[model samples]
Structures are given as structure tokens and as C-alpha cells.
Target: MPTIPGSRTLSGRVLIIFVAFLIAALALVGRLAYLQLIKAPEYASMAESSRTVNVTIPAKRGTIYDRNGNVLATSVDATTIYCDPTMVDDPREMADALAECLGGKSDDYLALITQDTTFVYVKRKADVNKAESLKEKGLSGLYFLPDSRRVYPYGSSAGQIVGASNIDDVGITGLELYYDDILSGVPGKMVYEQSATGIPIPNATVVERDAADGQDIIISIDIDMQIYMEERLSQGVADMGGSDGTAVLMDAATGEIYAIASTPYFNPGDLSEVEDGATSIKAITSGLEPGSIFKTVSATAILENGKMTPDTEVFCPAYLAVDEYYIEDMHERGDMTMTFRDIIRDSSNVGISLSVDEYLGYDKLYDKILEYGLHSATGVDYPGEEVGFLSDYSEWSMTQAYNISFGQGITCTPLQMTRFYGALRNDGVAVTPHFLVSLPQSGETPEYETEQIIQNTEAVPTMVDMLQTVVEEGTGVDAQMEGFTVVGKTGTAEFALETGGYSTTMSNRDFVGFLPNSTSSLVCYVGVDHVPVTGAVTPIFRDIMTFAVDQYRIAEQ
Candidate 1:
């Protein structure tokens, strides 16, 4: 085969080799042209992205303050410690030290760094001092990540109302949750390079947009008033042998809710010790069977119809007949004639029921209750508000009319009951109850605009006088204050059990009143379970109201 190489066969072989080489070169050129034309832009774009950098910057959340500009909720800088698993040396010492310093730690802190994991969070919400100390201690593989934590100065003081934020600084409850969108400020971001240590390059091209902070919210709530109400209600609930209760203070004229609180409540600052069920605003959001308090409406109906006055007489025999039902009063009295004032002062069940039946028939009684804002949501500023419980008029059972007369059948929230009484206090001018004075615009409507629900301009002197008698001469003397007069109503509604009749263990007790004439100044409602309704709460109402008058500088009594 080698001998023929110099012959024509060798020449032919060389020619064939040359032609194949030329064809291969042409094929390579054509492949390069196809790639350059079709996929050039795509590869160039990917290459550019690999060289570019992106970064994110946190927006500063808005500062929450009280009326006097005291900080309520705030954000403070914190350093989060993270460990690289492949760098730690002493497992036992690190675990013991972390468990002792950070608290609630039961795992090995150093062994975590000995594993294949790249990152491990050791502690959150640590300050510069703590992070510096940890760094100085020289536990390898540990690094600090910047973070922020929410702080509440007042402790558990206004926890439920001022509200708590989520882990990400978003509002979770109370006012925090209510104004979340406004409270959370605009977020800013940055685009830059990162080193192998995962730190951003200093003085690099950082795309920083200054974040806009959240606006200040001025609420109608008074911090001192809330403290006072909490103290008083806490004591009252304990003394009354009740597990939980609530008290609310409001302006009778403006429909401003001043102090609203519920027991078994929690402090937002320290939610760790708080039970799950202890943090709701039950005073406004929960409903209860309002007892004799409902009688005020019936008695008001009697007076409004000119069928009775404070001194108008009704013969009391302790029982009244309504259709097929025989309604009995708690107190069985002889056929003794008593004034309408006497009926209210005594909180007689039969008297009110008969009064409601006689003065205005079933239809009118229903109409007046609806007018007084019962069985309806007041559309208050607070969240989770529920419309009161009242079987519709058309669904009135045999015992419904009489039962509702003494506050047994119908149920209402503390807010609903207070708003109803607020109507009477406002001289029958129904207004929406509110905690905030103003709010940022949502869609087209401004936040918490005040509006009158019903306007009955004339002051019903008879209703005023009767409520006055309730405080000065009736069950509300326990509620009196120094240098002030209060008109109030009390309710002790019986609760039905799963068994039968009613349970003595659970009763919805209430005491509501306002200063001087109900159409003005201050008003409060105390909703206590298993507690006797007394006039003693009148002083609480008076003291808080008078203080509010001075604080807000309202018209002096």
C-alpha cells in the first residue's frame, strides 16, 4: 500500500483529502453564520445580567404616638445572628452559652455550624451591643444580619386597642390591623454587588428610593382614661367573682369612644405570656343578653307616647299576660300602685312589659326599638363588630315581647347597648359610634366620617327625668361621683342553659349612664357577668367623664 503512494492512487487520495477539508471548512462557516444571526441577542442579554447587581432596602415603618405625642408603637434597629455550619469548633460551650444568654434555647448552637448547612439563625431582634459581644467572643462562622423589632412603651396598658403588629411589622390587631395599609410605609430598594462574605459592596451603584413613612393617627381614645377604666373594671370583675368583663367610656354628645377595654386582655409588648383567647376587643365585638337595660327603651316608649310620665301610675301585681304567655317579675308584689319612676327604679319585668303593651302595641314597641338602634350594627370604627341579637318582629315568640321587655330575649354588644343609650343621652339623636377622629381616605370615603343616624331634636324630658331618678334615687347611686350628677340604667339578663330555665353561673350584667342630661358630655357602659347591677358605677362614669371634660377641654359642667 505504501509503494503506491507516489503513484496516481496517492495523488487521488491527497485530492480526496483536500476536498473533504474544504467541505468541512464551509460547513463550519455556515454553522457560525446561523448561530450569529439567530441567538446573538439572547446570549448577550444573559451575559449582561450576570454582570449587573440587584439589592433590596427596607422602608421605615411609621411611628405610632398618643394624643400628646407619646410613642405607642415604634421600630428599632436589631442585629440577627446567623451561623455558617462549617466554621464552628466548640459545640458544648456554644450550646450552653446560647441557652443561657438568649433564653428558650435547647439545641446545640455550635454543632449547627459543623453541618453542611450554609446558614442558621441563632437569635432574632438582637441589638448592636449583644451582637458585638457575641462577635468579640470569637465563635467562628457567626455573622450578623440587620433587622428591626417593634416596641411598645406602655407594656400591657393599651395592648388590645393600640394593637400589635405581625412579624414583618404589619399590623395584626386593634388599630394596628385596622390601619395596616396606611401604617406600612412605601418600601425602598437598592441594586449593588456582593462579596463572598455576602456583604454589599460599599459605595457601589445603589438604587435607593427614600421610603415614605406612615402618617400619624389621632384617636379619640385617652390613654389615662383607658388606664383608669382598666383598673376599675379589673377590680370590679375580681370583686364580682367574674372571670372577664369590659367597660367603655364615650362622649354622649360627639359619639366618641374614649376608653374601651375587655378583661382577659393581653399586652402587645409581651405576647409570649398571653393566652390565645385573652386578646380580643370583646367590649365592642362580642354580644351579650342585655337584661333590664332594655327596659329603658320600653319605659321610654311609654313616656314618648304621652301614655305615662315619671309619676304615671301602674298597678303592680308582679305578673302580666301576653297572648299565651304569663310573664312574671323577679319580685312578686301585691296589687300596689306605683309610679312609672318606681317601675324603672325597681327594674320590674312585668311593669315594663305591660307598659310596652299598653302605651304602644306590639308594632309600635318594635318600631321604637328599631329607632333606638337595637338589633343593628352601629357601623363603629372597631373591627369584628356584630349586629345585636334580636329575633325579628315577625318572628316574635309567645314570650319574645315580654322577655325582650326585661332584656332576656334580645342580645347586644356593649357598643350597641351604649349607642342605644347614647341616642337617649343625645336626646334621641342616633349617631355612629367611633374611636378615631379622622382617617386616611379609603377608595372615595374619608376615614370615620361622623354622621347622625336619627334626628329627634326635642329633648324627651320624661325619659331624661326617669334616667335621672335611676341614678339619684334608684340602682345607679353606686355609680355616683363627687361634684357631678349621673343618669343611668342597669341590666341583669338571665342566660338560658343547655338544660332548661336560666343559669345562675352566667348572667349578663350592665350599668350605663351619662352626666347631668344624657344629651351631653360623658357616657359609659359596664358589662359584667354574674355581677349585681348597682349605682356605684355612677361614680366611675362621673370621674372619667369629668376628667375627659377637663382633658379635652370640653364645656365645663
Candidate 2:
């Protein structure tokens, strides 16, 4: 009765609809099976990534120690405070509270707390006292991470040399920059389960990859000598009313720098007010024309070529014309006959020109300068080292030759000069200057290699004797010590002006030599700039030399 008109057609239509529905459901089931069986691992990893938190563990930086095993730079445990700004209930209030406890402006904290990022740093390497104060507030959505901060125990002592690290613990300059790869240890990872809002779920299983700490480094610097040299050099600069100064002490035989400082000091601990260009280690970085100090090279060339002996005679006048220039003696008047040794002892410009041209010749003089490490970088293990400036001998005029012969017209760093002096003290065998003594390797002691620059061993003693005569009875007499044989040369040269001629008001007064009384040879170089007198730095050199001889227990005659 119900299926009257078109009842058969209606039933057929309903059946077709039912069959179509069943087919669609089967297709859906097949799709679900394919996903569950074939791609289970991929979907599982995607889900895990959304719920798990991965944190990086920074490696501990290496410790820096002086030659005597005194720790100069190290790392200390610290806490870094972080938070999810999205999870914070009231960012302004939280920032205000944090500012009161952490000693920063409230606006700065507000900006950090209101950031759109999921994670933001509130304070890194926080002080324990401040962190405890913030903890007492029991703030929500805030977390603390274990971190390490760089520390310099000796404060400003050797600060520029050791340098400083950035907030992320990357080295920026000096030895730290040079040895960054060796000093930065291996970083690690940590993963843990977290809630929807990014907070770690308590009691959840945690997996961590432990970080390997960096190796400890031992440098060749002796802190005692460093302190002494810096103190006296600072005082000398002040007393002489000079602008700046640099000093270096090295083991003549090995080229190991014992104490090297450039005034004023750079404080690595607090870098908020670091002066521009103040952190440069000028001993190896700054190059200047050394006045009479260069004469030693000429004197060496003269003797090495067999053109003159210490007793050989020459005539020195007040001034002499050469090429387009006139070379003059600094003080003495009238023509006088003097021994070849007296030329260097008196630091005579005319005498050097007469000998360098008449006897040593240009080719031999140029070769000797190259042998002294003056024409190239000293190959030091530090960053930003400079090479000496020397024109090719083929381009040399008579004036250039005479100027170089008298230590003018050429430029070299204080480190290069000290290295040359070291060669004179070490049997004429120049060594590559270096600061690193060892670096830890595979839990074993550090390894090292040696480099020699010169091979003429016999010439060392002869030059040493000649330099000794300068200190005994010449311009370097101010550097003389009571019981030690001080061998060195004094130099006073005006700064070359950028416009043309030399500066009338500024000069570099210097003394470079070694102490032979010590069991091991010690080379020292002192430079004072922007002063009127020439020998002002010699007394400073004397004080440091005397102290070194006494402190190191060097023998006295």
C-alpha cells in the first residue's frame, strides 16, 4: 500500500544510495590503513617535535695560565634567566619586578618580556645575589639555565694580551682570538618533554649529550716580571710626561716573551668604557723608525764583512753632504779621528754613512737587515702582528742608504727589534718570537715546535761584546746596572709627519739590549714616545733591568 506510484523506482534509488555510501566508507578505511602502516614513523616524529624541547649546552672555555702556573683567566658557573613572553600573564608587571631585583631599567625588561618570540633572555650570566632576589619573587613563565661566564682573576694585568669574550662566549681579540678554535670546547644538546605552553613536564624522561670542556693553555709570560715591567714603564711614562710607552722582556735563546706590556693597560673584566685602539699589543703591532738602534745592524755588517774591526780608525765631521741630503752628527762639533767602535758608542750618523758606504756597501747592508728579521713579520703566535717597512735596495738613494744605516728611513716593530737583540745575545741565531708554550691534547701534556731565524753562531758573541761596550761607556750608559753586564743601544728619533718632515715636538726614545749576568739570557726593550730628551727611557730600562736581574736570581759579578 505504501509503495504505490513509482514505489519500485524509489526502492531502487535508495539501494543505489546505500551502495555509494558503503564504497566511500571503504575508501576512507583504506586511506587510514595506508597512513597508519606505511608512514607511522614520520607522523610519530612530527608529533614528538611539537611536544619535545631541545636546549643547547654551551661548552666550558679553556683556562689561561701564566708561565709559573698562576691562573690568569678562567670560567665560572653562572645562571641565565629566560622566559616565554607569550606565556606571561602580565609582561609589564613582571618586567617591573625583575628590574627592581636585577638592577636594570624597567623599560628594558618590559621590552624583553613583551617580545613576540617564544623564548627571550631576561638576564644572562646573572649575579647570584640578583638571581636569588628574583627567585624569591616566584615569578611564573620564567626559567633558569646553567651557563658559564669568562673571568679574569688578575684584572688588568696582561688584559689586552688575554683579551675578552663576547656574551655568547666567542673570542674577539688578542690570544683569545688567535686560539679561538683550540679554546672553544665542544657544545652539546639536551632534549626533554614539555607541556603545551613550553614548560618542561616534571618527571619526564630526559636525555642529554654531555659537553666536553676545553683544554687548559700555558703561556710563556712570567706574571712577576710582567707586573714589574708594567709598573716601572707606567711610572716612566708619567714621570717623563710622555704620551705612550711599550716594553718587552724575552728569553734571548728561545724567543719566549717573559714580560711584555704596552701602556696603558686594557681591562678585560669591564669593557664598558674601553678606549679605541687602547687594547692593541703595540709591541708587535706598531712599527716605527728606530734612530741609533739600527746602527747595531750596520756595525754587525761591517765586522761580518771584515771591512773594519773595533780598533779601525775613521774621520767623523759635524756634517757631511751625500746625494741630495746632508747627514750630521747629533752633538759633537769639528772633525775628529775616532775608532770604529767609537762610532756606534757615540751613535754617529756621519760615521754610519762613512762606514756603510765606504766599507760595508749597499748590498751587504741590505742582506744584513734581512738576516735580522727586519724586512718581514716575526712569525709570532699572536694576532695582528705587523711586518717591517723597507724599500728595495735597487730603489735606494744615497740618502736612503745613509738614513737606514743610522736607523732612520726604515720601520720595524718593537717585537722585531727585541728579536734582533735576542739574536745578538743568542750566538747570532735568531728565533721566532712566540707566547704559547703548550696546549693540552688528549689528556696529555702540550706539544711544541722550535724555529730559528739565523745560523751564524760565532757572530753572536762578537756583537754581544760590542753592545756591552755601548752600555759600559756610551749613550746607553744610563741603562747600566750595578753588578750586571747590560748590553744595549739607545735610540732617539722624531716621528715622521704625514705632511712631510719629522715632528719637532714628538720623538721615540728607546733602549734595547740583554742582561748576560743571568743563567739564561734575558732580552729587554723599552720605548718612550713624545718626549724632549733622548735618554729618558734609559733610566726606566735600568730600573726594570735591575729588578729582573734581582728577581730572577741572575748572578752578579
Candidate 3:
């Protein structure tokens, strides 16, 4: 061990190696500390994701029921096919295998797998058997996710009102969309450490977060009545030979929507059948210049003005001159001295105009119109609502003032029309329409029995009496139901476009009445649009109410 030339340098090199190793060890320790302590949560999450495959288990959507507890909408289990490109290492092989089961989308499926994305859904909403078949093949890169497909137990029954859900198992339209927050519950997680063969690893931990399913919705819709309305209105649209139709029912006292049906309705389960017609709730969302249906507003105006009573007399000529304008009826009134009762029953444009001119004046007529819930959204629980157009006076023509009185020159939704009728039924209380009975079973219970939208409705009873005359002896005789002292009105609205003039081609056949033949009872409104050139649907309304009373054992009038 004698120190020689360059021998001492060997020892120095050894020391250098030792120091370098110590420093490297320190650096390694520091990095480990950072990963385990400073950023532990981030790393832990990433590690969890890599070690455990988390699949979504969609919670069952709640069943939707009508007021009588009839099932209108419900949710059932369905499986969908999806692919994880990372899992399916072989693209071409997997795509070809999928094509046989998927039906005519081989290249599309192949292109989908070859994409740079980690997850790609080749198909959704496939039948459970199809997903099971794909599962049976044990395809490496494919996955099956469970979802809830909405089933309208009463197909096209309350299609428009019940609405539809999306591929995500989320509600998209109707009450389904409106109450999504409640109808869509939390998704459950299924996590398991799996081997490359897709089998659960031995002794591996499975972390689970249980999902709470969506709560059921008990709507005020009456199923049997809804069926009857759809049948009747569909017939009415056919009878009137018009294009389309809508019918809405409301509880006069509570403002609950009993039934809202539109034909031809698109299935909430399958949208492929949807067409370009004004089906669904178009009668509410699509506003139109209603023909004689608007005379109700004018009648309200006249009655509010004190210039006319239900029995008050007014003379109607074939043509009445208001300012420089001549207002005429569909049929000549022949200058008859008609009472207000006769005015509505006769549906005399001349008589209504004369009453509007003499009693309502201008401002009073407009105020009465607003009071009756015209020119506003009915504020129902739904998406895509519009406020019916009520042009201000300065924008109004002399003809508009009178035309508005007769249900022309003004625009409204079927829901708004029902509200106007609701005001008449509820003794002047303009009730806002509602769908839900309570909140989700998981959420806080709602304060049931909500109230009214209209403030001053003392004049409603008087209007009801006048409207009753229209049914008892007036123009709405077609709306009367046997064994029921029906109080209602009929409106044959000639459909017109906003930009174009009155439509000579299409019209709205409407019959709205309430039954059990008593006061403080159910009020139903049926408005049919673009009737098929076949026949009248009002009789359907009578049948529906007639059936409703008889079915529910609501005492006959």
C-alpha cells in the first residue's frame, strides 16, 4: 500500500464516485418525497385511474304517472355498445367482427376505432341482446354501458308532454327536460383492477360509490282523458280537414295540467318518426292569428266595460262600420237585435265588433285582453315557449282593433287559450299551469297547492255565465256532453301566417268546455289545428269528457 506516482489519484477518483452516488441518492429521495407528499392526491388519482377501470352504471330513471296514477312514462334497462381503442389493440380485426352485429357500418366502425381518441362509441341504444352478443364474443376493445331508455307506456299518449330523453340517459324535451335535475340521478361507479384478459385481478380492491336512482314523477295528466282527446282532436282535425290539432286540460281550481296532447305526436322513445307537421306542443310554441277563438277576449272586454251584459242587446248588421273600416262576419248577421248570449252563440263578427267599439273603447279592450292572459307566455313547465303577439295600440289598425275582438289579428298558443278559459272557469282567477305534483323523493318536499297567476278576477263569474250560455244555447252546442251541464265555447279559427295574410288553406277547430256539469270542477280545452280534410273532432272532446266523468264516477249533471 505504498503511495506511488498517480497511485494517489486513484483514491481521489473513488471519493468522487462516492460523493456523486450520495447526491444522486438525495435527489431520488427528494423526488419520492414530492410525489408521495406534495402531489399525493394528483398521483393517487392517476394511479387509481390506471390501476382500476371505472365503468358507469346508469341509475334507473323514475316512472312517470298521470294524476290517477296511470303510467304515462317509464324507464327500462337498455345496453349500448362502445369501444376503447386502447383496449382493442387490433383495429381491423375488431371492426370486422363488430360489423356483423352492428349492421352495415363496417368502414364507419373501422374508421371510428382507428381514430386517435381513447374512447369511441360505435353505437348507442342498441338492444340488450345485441350488446350481450358482442359481449359473448368477448371482444377485447369493446365495452357495454347500461342506460335507461324512456318507454311511453301509452305510446304517443302524452308524447309531447312527457317528452323524451337523449342517448346519455338524460331528459331532453317536455317535462323530462324541464325537470332533468331531479329526473336524472347520480351515476354509480364500478371500479375493478383487471388483468389484460379483462378478468378481475386476484386480491385487487374494488372501490364503489353507490348511485341513487331518479325519483318518479306523478303528473296531473289524466291518461284515459288524454287518449280520448287525442282520438277526438285527431278526428276533428280530420273532420275540419285542417292540418293539425292540440288539446290541453287544466284543473280550474289548482292550475294543474291534466292532459296536453298533440297529434301526430313523435315517440319519446323514437324520434325517427317525427315529421314536419305542427305536432307536439306546436299549438303552444307556434303562435298564430286565431280566427273566431279570440272573440272570447272581446266578450271579456265588452263585459268589463259595463257596456254589455250577457243579456244586454246589441244590433249586428251584415257589415258594421268602425271608423273608416267595415267589419263583417263569416255569415251575415242581418242587422238583428241580438243579446250578448246570442252574440257569442251566433259568433257574429258584427255583433262582437259593435260591442267592442261601444263598450270596450280602445284602452279598456287592451286592458281586458291583458287581464284575460293574452299576449303573454302561459309559463308552463317546458322549453321553447313564446309570448303570443298582442300588438300595441299605436301599431294597431282600426280593423285590427275589431279584428282582434273576433280572435283575428292576435296571436296565441293553445296553452294561453286554456288559461283565458281558466280565468273564465275559476271565477276570474287566471291560474298558471303546472305539471309536477312534488319534487324528487330525494330532494326536499315541495309546498304543494300553489296559487294563481291572475290577481283581479271578480269579473270571471260573469264571463263564465256568458260562456255557459254559448254552450247551453249558443255557438258551442257541439261541445255539450250528455249528462253533463257543460260550460264551454267553440272556436273555428282560420289559420293565418304572421308575414302572409289569413290562410285560405288551413284552419284551427277548437272546442273547450268543462264538465261534471257543476261549478268548481274540471275544465278542458281542445284546440285542433290544420284539420285533415276528413271530419270534425269536437265530438271527440265530448266523448272524452263524457268518458272521463263516467269512468271517474264524477256525478253526472
In angstroms, the error of model 3 at 13 is 12
Give the 10-residue window scoring lowest on summed lDDT in candidate 1.
440-449
For model 2, the stretches where C-alpha displacement exceeds 4 angstroms are: 1-30, 37-44, 197-199, 205-207, 440-456, 533-535
Please report, as a residue range, the 10-residue window in candidate 3 with the lowest summed lDDT.
Answer: 445-454
* Candidate maximizing TM-score: 2
Q: Report the Cα lDDT for residue 208, model 2.
A: 79
Q: Give the TM-score of candidate 3.
A: 0.82
Best by lDDT: 2
Assess each prediction's global lDDT (C-alpha) against the native: 0.70, 0.82, 0.72
- Tens digits of per-residue lDDT, candidate 2, 192-274, equal 67787767678874647887777778888888888888889999998887888999988877768888999888788888888
- Candidate 1 lDDT over 1-557, as tens digits, reads 46654688888999999999999999999899878987788887676455445433445466666655567777788776766554566766667666665665546554554567555777766776777776777765565656667788877777888888866677888888887777777756655543455444467655667556666566677777778778877877776666677788777677777788888778887767887656668877888788888887777766667766677788777576667767776556766777788989888887777777777777777887777777777877666787767777899875787788788877778887787677776666666777666533332333443434344333255677788788777777776655556678877778777788787555666788777632245668887775543323444455556666666655525
Candidate 1 TM-score over all chains jointly: 0.83
Cα lDDT of candidate 1 equals: 0.70
Better of 1 and 2 by lDDT: 2
Q: Candidate 1: misplaced stretches above 4 Å?
A: 1-57, 83-107, 111-120, 135-141, 188-212, 305-307, 321-326, 438-455, 498-501, 517-520, 532-556
TM-score of candidate 2 to 2 decimals: 0.91
